[model samples]
Target: MINQLRVKQRDEYYSLEVESGSNLLDVLRRENYFIETPCGGRGVCGKCRVTVNGQTALACQTVIDRDMLVELQNEEKTDILMTGISVQGVLDGTHLYVMAFDIGTTTIVGYLMNGISGELLTQVSSLNPQKAYGADVISRIQYAITTDAEELRKMICGTLLELLNEAAKSVKIKTDEIALVSIVGNTAMHHLLLGIDVKSLITPPYMPKVYEAVELAMQKLFSEHTEGVVRILPNIAGFVGADTVGCLVATRFDHLKKMTLLIDIGTNGEMVLGNWQRRIACSTAAGPAFEGANIQCGMRGQKGAIDHVEVQDGKLVFHVIGGGVAKGFCGSGLLDLVASLLQIGEIDGSGRLMNGKEYRLSDTDVYLTQKDVREVQLAKAAIRAGIELLTKKIGISISKIEKVYLAGAFGNYMNPKSACLIGMIPICLLDRIEGIGNAAGEGAKLCALSKTEYEYSKILASETEFLELASLTEFQDVFVDSLKFTEENDEYL
Candidate 1:
């Protein structure tokens, strides 16, 4: 029997026909909705939450048989930055405009700018279509190794093509008139976009098959586009792909004379520490805790996900993304909630949820379980310990760092005080921490705007050092020790 599925996404309605017994996730993925499926549709990862007939349920576990109004809990309206400064100089070197992209695992953003003035013409942001396969980089890598590798390449390239078409049409220009496209993302995103083998990436040592920056003909991916070259930024280490390199470029860390550190935390936490004299990079598999994965009642930064929380007048008050009912917790709220719990002496310094079994945000369904507290601890521990290890490798104390550049959208929205309270950032360097919003995208725009910036990144990548975090023996001990919420070991449990 045929069933009429009436889906409510944001403020719009989607009416569609489907066969009986069809899974909601399968139907959604087929329609390009890309609801998160970290377990690959095994009914795990409870990230795919939707509502059927006003009742909340997991999309993967729901079987559609009757016509019902389904509400999408994952949908949101994002005010993205479409334009930013790339380089100081610009010239009309080509006949067509330059298009840039920052391909993230969770979201993809595109920019269309003027060829002469390097001014932004238009921009757009959408969910990455590959989220249907998995959430984190490792899960996506596993999907490629076991399933069809070409599948991922096509899906991602298709998203890029959509961005390109949307951008070109917004300016009333032909696709072939686009002069060049510069792309930047993490290692898995970079490799998958180019259809490279990721076997070595998931194996021991975790080295990428292609580490250097690459330039490909635009016609190779989209034959209809112009014969311009598509530049993929260089990789600094195994998990630290061109996006990290772009972060370095955007911050101008290579030319600065003082000690600088750049940390871009996502499903994978990648950071770089150095200055003009020396540069070193590393990547930690911090898991997807920061992006609202692997925790009970966790979600991406969307409407109803508690984005901000604090202890106000000896009570916890939180602000939701859309200012409606609370559904789950996002990255920023998680950081703030944990830090508040710590300050209130509810959760101990050793990352234990004390004085109660779980922490309640409000009198609603929202809560922070003890296990959720543990997840955040592990995530922060990995990040904090990685910074310490990099500092030791460079023979410098954490206090010597002059500037700490926070890249990615999460970093931009996160509260600096909460990050410092949880020990994810050094207490001494709290004032030095600055959020550089979408630096990867900005870096790509810079490269496309000027040839000088592109060549500068290549030279910087060549001189940088890559330290394998997996190869370090002290990583385990330091991580366990860094789980404390404070530096005071005397008070920690």
Candidate 2:
């Protein structure tokens, strides 16, 4: 295959052999270097940039060569911090630490926090490495089913190792110093991390192999360094993972007496409806339309990504996240743009882009193609239908929702009023809506910081009832009704 290479950082040097096609990132991680390659060996994010023969190149982008010499770049000189779960007062004078890992389908966020103070020390996030295979979990599952299973595992594990190393380095500790880690993710994501086959999730049965708490030693997961234990937050059902459990915990749903709903919108949209009496959960495959994927010109919320779009004086005005030139549209920007168009009668209730003529705004072409409308239609239909079905299942009306918490990265940037115009959300719940950014991460952090919270999550997972949307007979009718926009007497807009 290939020759051995030497990698040096600080005062230590390591030798390793790699195949010719292997990238430096893979080699370094294999050697337990804890290099963070958030883009899954892709050339994006630039987090894995390193010095190779005094030249700066993305570790994931460069291939290994014979007798190559490498050094850690200036950005890579941070010390590795020990992190993980811990029981209070178990170890002698060592500082207690825990890590919360939000394993999202699109991105992963890690929080290194003190187990006692509830203070966040360091946070690290990056695109999920599995993105190289596909953007969503379903695509990744399909790839795993047809292509390579072991490779998928390697990719996921490698990405996690990078995150673990980065968090450790940021906090100036070793891997062994960390005590415990709690992770939150959807069903497919949880399955992938545990190396469980997910083919059953996509077909008729729609069953998950496990929905309870899973515990494994860190060393068992990684060969090079694994000193602590990893606790996967218990999942609710087929689609709802520990992430939803975290959302419930973060929002204190159990403490509320009134009816409430938590909707975390993403590639797979999940909603939880409950109150003091009982809690029920369901999931819908909303696709990547909202995340700026599977569209003509879509991108994630990053530099130059259009975050807001509206029509002023029959001309399009858009705001980019970094206030730079518009490169492409993000989820929030797409949602606002689509909703604005609908409000102006440019798009009908059926989501047809009208105007019947060419239009140009500020040197940029502005036109919603039939396909774009259809995409928004599908995304909105899934989310709205989910909300309606859950509310009906609980025998409550839209007005009965006392609070609605929005979770996920995109939700943090969305305009609630605009979201209502397109009927993506009910207008009555607009005032009660609050964006809770990365509740999964927060829940993970709570688990890291408190043993009580970790145990509470286990209890919550068991007590929470999961309702499979696919199995519900009235689900199709609710979905069809939700597709039509409610125009009259809506105040949330």
Candidate with maximal lDDT = 1
Q: Candidate 1 at residue 156, lDDT?
A: 88
Model 1 has an lDDT value of 0.83
lDDT, candidate 2, 345-421, per-residue tens? 77777766677532222445434456766777788888888888888888888889998878887677788877777
For candidate 2, the 10 contiguous residues with the lowest summed lDDT are 76-85
Which runs in model 1 stand beyond 4 Å of their true positions? 1-24, 51-57, 61-74, 79-92, 489-493
Q: Against the hidden reference, what TM-scores do the models get?
A: 0.91, 0.80
- Candidate 1: worst-modelled 10 consecutive residues by lDDT: 78-87
RMSD in Å for model 2:
7.9
